[model samples]
Target: MTEDTAAGNTEAPANPQVKMRVLGQFIRDMSFENVMAQKGIAGDVQPEISVQVNLDAKKRPVEHQFEVSIKLKLTSKAKGMEDVLFLCEIDYCGLFHVEGVPEDQLHPFLLIECPRMLFPFLRRIVSDITRDGGFPPVNLDSIDFVALYRNELMRRQAEQANKTEA
Candidate 1:
């Protein structure tokens, strides 16, 4: 109020530009089961696909380094009979070096931005796994990380509200 008001300047100081780097990435675990191969299929079949995504982040012992993991679970089944065609699950992780993010913004940054960076690799793995398992290759649609984060936040808030009411 003293110097700034006198100078006719009211804007706050600008935040530093965010800095990010992907140190490395890898698949921590993967399992693909081809049920159709084992049981054999005999009919005109329609496929239904379902996919689930979960994200986790942890700070590493090394400074400025963190680990973020994306868990992808996908399943395909025959439309009406509900016979499972195949199941593919993967846990992919990335090591990142990040700086200049505010403490309050870190959680969403890790969950959203980090996963976005790793999504293409995970998508390719899913496509490859399905193609190799003798099914029509699954090309996953792009995920909405911003919506995912907002939905998660709303869910947690509702959960907390329910607990308090109880």
Candidate 2:
């Protein structure tokens, strides 16, 4: 028997080691609009708000590194009025070192896990920006990363299936 095999270290040495880390976090873009400011609007009426969140990840050419970013868009319309109370959009990003994750599991890890780590910061930024824009802080609810990942996978699969059938 080979000495290495006898020692039971059968795995290949070059197999990427599994590790995850956050290297940095920063706001890549930010925009805030207070449409009603010109009208000298006051806080007499509560506004209806809508928010959208999107996540994207890209692998760096360097080994075991990735950039994960979350894009948040929020719009508040003055209730019972035609004016837009405020609009805020932010693209927040984080640098991550992820290694050893298997190819099959890597996509989910990047989309789900990496964002999971960066969410609180992104959420805080949204709230602060909204508050600074002269409206009540819009507190974002917790996101469902697993659901988002699964939905994205399903969408891709459906798209592929359509392409194949057509």
The model with the greatest lDDT is 1
Local error of candidate 1 at 42, Å? 3.7
- Tens digits of per-residue lDDT for model 1 on 1-166? 5988899988888998899999999999999999987897766678899999988999999987899999999989999777898899999999999999999999999999999999999999899999998877899999999899899999999999999999
Off by over 4 Å in 1: 1-13
Candidate 1: lDDT over CA atoms?
0.92
lDDT of 1 at 72: 90
**Model 2: which ten-residue window has the lowest total lDDT?**
38-47
Candidate No. with top TM-score: 1
Error of 1 at 16 (Å): 1.6
Off by over 4 Å in 2: 1-17, 80-82
lDDT of each: 0.92, 0.89
Q: Each candidate: how many clashes? A: 0, 2
Using all chains and alpha carbons, the TM-scores for the candidates as numbered come to 0.90, 0.84
TM-score of 2: 0.84
- Model 1 clash pairs are none
